[model samples]
Target: MKKSIYRLIKFSILPLLFICYAIYITGKNTGDFYKRFSSPQQNSLILGSSRAASMNPEIIDQIIHSKYPNAKLYNYAFTWAHSPYGPKYLESIEKKIKPDTKDGVFIVTVEPTALMVDKNKPDDPQYYTENDKSVAKTSMVATNPNLEYLLESYDFSITNEFNKKIRPEKNPMIEVSVLDNGQVHGKVIKRFSTEKRKEVNAEKMAELKNRINELKISPTRLEYLSKTIDFLKQHGKVMVVRMPVSKVPYDIENSAVADFDKIILDITESKKVPYINYNNYPNNYQWVDEVHLEPEFMDKFSAVIAKDLVH
Candidate 1:
């Protein structure tokens, strides 16, 4: 009986060791592959959902470096990253900031839907797909600056050849490229013709409207936002920004969330932080879709915000 038990233990331990080694190798390869894609600096952080991902760190840095030469900004935003994830993410990246770092500016884009909560409803998996890469995987490597964290969080799906093949074209509606500076450039994928683009935009806009209608600002999320502000204040100045959507969708969102500005204003005012609302951007800046601007306008938008930030 003892011999049989020992044999079982030997077999189990060998398989466990092999699994551990595989995890380590998979993580090392993928982590190194993605390391070429993100920045190492962290004096400034851009935080929000996909909206905040649009801000180009290089463009913003160019505008501010003359005034604050030492400032290094990294876009830390991810898709479907709302208030629920913000506080934890901020905490996770604390070690990345240098001990002597000062004048660290944190720009956070406030998306209205992030404030809402519906406990009874489960989130759509499509809303939070890790079809290609996981922010948590890349982020763990970024903040910890080690292989262990990266290995522990690595998803096995990344190893699948089928997943790799489709990753480049994941999310046919919006194609995003995350650069070394952590700036994510997203383009609306217009397949065949202008008519197809219009059709896609209309469907997305309708879905967004439906989601907006069901949104209810949760007290818990508001509390989390408040905590996030307080936590960020420990590092440096904080700015709350409201990014612009196209006219029709913007108007619909405004009508749905009556106290949107008021809520943001109250938080900023109480926290003594600045709030920049670009919801009324001039007609000249073109939009790729209801919520995102075309790449041509990204630099202009970043310039506007960076100018304000430096001043």
Candidate 2:
């Protein structure tokens, strides 16, 4: 009986330990979202969708340190599907930020897509897409080796993550790395040819069109955006920014929501926070797609934002 019990314990405990270790290592090395979850609570944060994920927190810190000393900015931005202004994201943000934080900087990036929800059930929290995602479901966001996120939210296998870290793909189409400081660095291994660029643009346009049909601007989400700003106000300054995009998608967004800028301006005015619309800036920077800024231009963009914040 004693021998059988010992064998059972060995079999179960050993594999469990191995899995825990593998998960820890995987969280440390691979998965873009994993590193964000494993890190400690941030003093300052950059919040938005994938468009804002590539905003380099380190670059922003270096440039803005003189004005706001020791301000550690973490990019808590996820994707359009996961981080739209809603209760789920607000809950996650609340968990990620330190409770006692005062005089912290918060950058909230705005776009039409993020403020949209399913047209059929715009008011129902139960049917929200983000509720099914890690950002909404994960209870603990500031813990090292967040086991809950690794087990539930991590999409890739542990073996795959290990393979990526050990033997990275050579000349891959794209390479993405999530830094300890919570910045997501995505490198385009090679620039797209003219034909390839056209193809990508067409696909993105179609996706945007489909979303326009399926979703609508949510009053609930807009309210949450206000709540997010109000909550961040207690900590410190909150800057609302509208990131720049290429002409094609920009036209579509503006056409979809004619009053988008006015809506954002009203909110900013009411909240008494600065609103910077980079869309009004000269479109000289490169883009990976119609919406996302190219990684090469991220530092320049971050520097511009940092300077704008202080001046």
Candidate 3:
């Protein structure tokens, strides 16, 4: 009996220690937003999906600083499902803005899908979708990190950790390193030929075009977005923008959601917020994928955004 008890303790303790070690290594790279939640001190915030993640806050600030010398921009963007309607956006707002934050600028970039029901997944239990729940969990951990967060950081395989240590690749999914100003350098790791991607997307457009009413802009999202705008307005000016994508994907988006721009315009006009659709801008920019901007173009894009904000 003593031998049996000793064996149990030996087995349990070893596994526990291993798990603790895994968590420690995995937790090392929790991304930038998680790091910022501890003390989210900033003057300007750029909020949106993956496209917004590609923005360089440092470049945007440099371009705008001449006009507002003290201005700062923090890119607080996550990937899919981090929509304005979601709890992540609200939680981030709560974390980033304090009662004393009297003056700031809130730039919100919108993707059509952000307002449309995904129809591909369960919608209840807010911020608990598979893709976003872990991210939201990770970000919330920043407020008060604990053992659970440590566990959440653990990957089942140590090989993944080993590979990273041996050859650290900037996580193609989320920026591995974030600057103090919350600038994330998300890179475009892969791309498909524009014509080929467009051809593939055309079929997707057909499916969506038929489901317009079923997948129409979510009223619930609009309501929450308005709430976010109202909250930001009390603290600072608000700007709504639709970032640029390639022409083919842009056309497909239009086909998928009719009058999408009109709806956005109505909302912005009602709220008296400035709205810019960079799609309408000259097609001088380049794309890494059908939807994301190339890194080289970000500086020029940031300059354009700065000019728009200043005006």
TM-score of each: 0.73, 0.93, 0.73
Off by over 4 Å in 3: 1-41, 119-132, 135-150, 153-163, 167-177, 187-214
User: Can you rank all candidates by TM-score, best first?
Assistant: 2, 3, 1
| lDDT for position 261 in model 2 | 93
| Residue-level error in angstroms, candidate 1, position 275 | 0.3
Best by TM-score: 2
lDDT tens per residue, model 2, 116-150: 88888847677788988989978889887687887
**How does each model score on lDDT?**
0.65, 0.87, 0.65
Across residues 118-211, which tens digit of lDDT does each residue of candidate 1 receive? 4345443233223224443344435323444445443444343334444644557655455666676665674447887789899988988887
Q: Which stretches of candidate 2 lie over 4 Å from their true place?
A: 1-17, 165-171
Candidate 1: how large is its RMSD?
6.8
Q: For candidate 3, write residues 11-121 as lDDT tens digits.
A: 999887866565445434444343444334566778877778767777777777776665577777666464444555665565666556656777888877766665654
Score candidate 2 by lDDT. 0.87
**For each candidate, how many residue pairs have backbone atoms clashing (under 3 Å)?**
0, 0, 0
TM value for model 1? 0.73
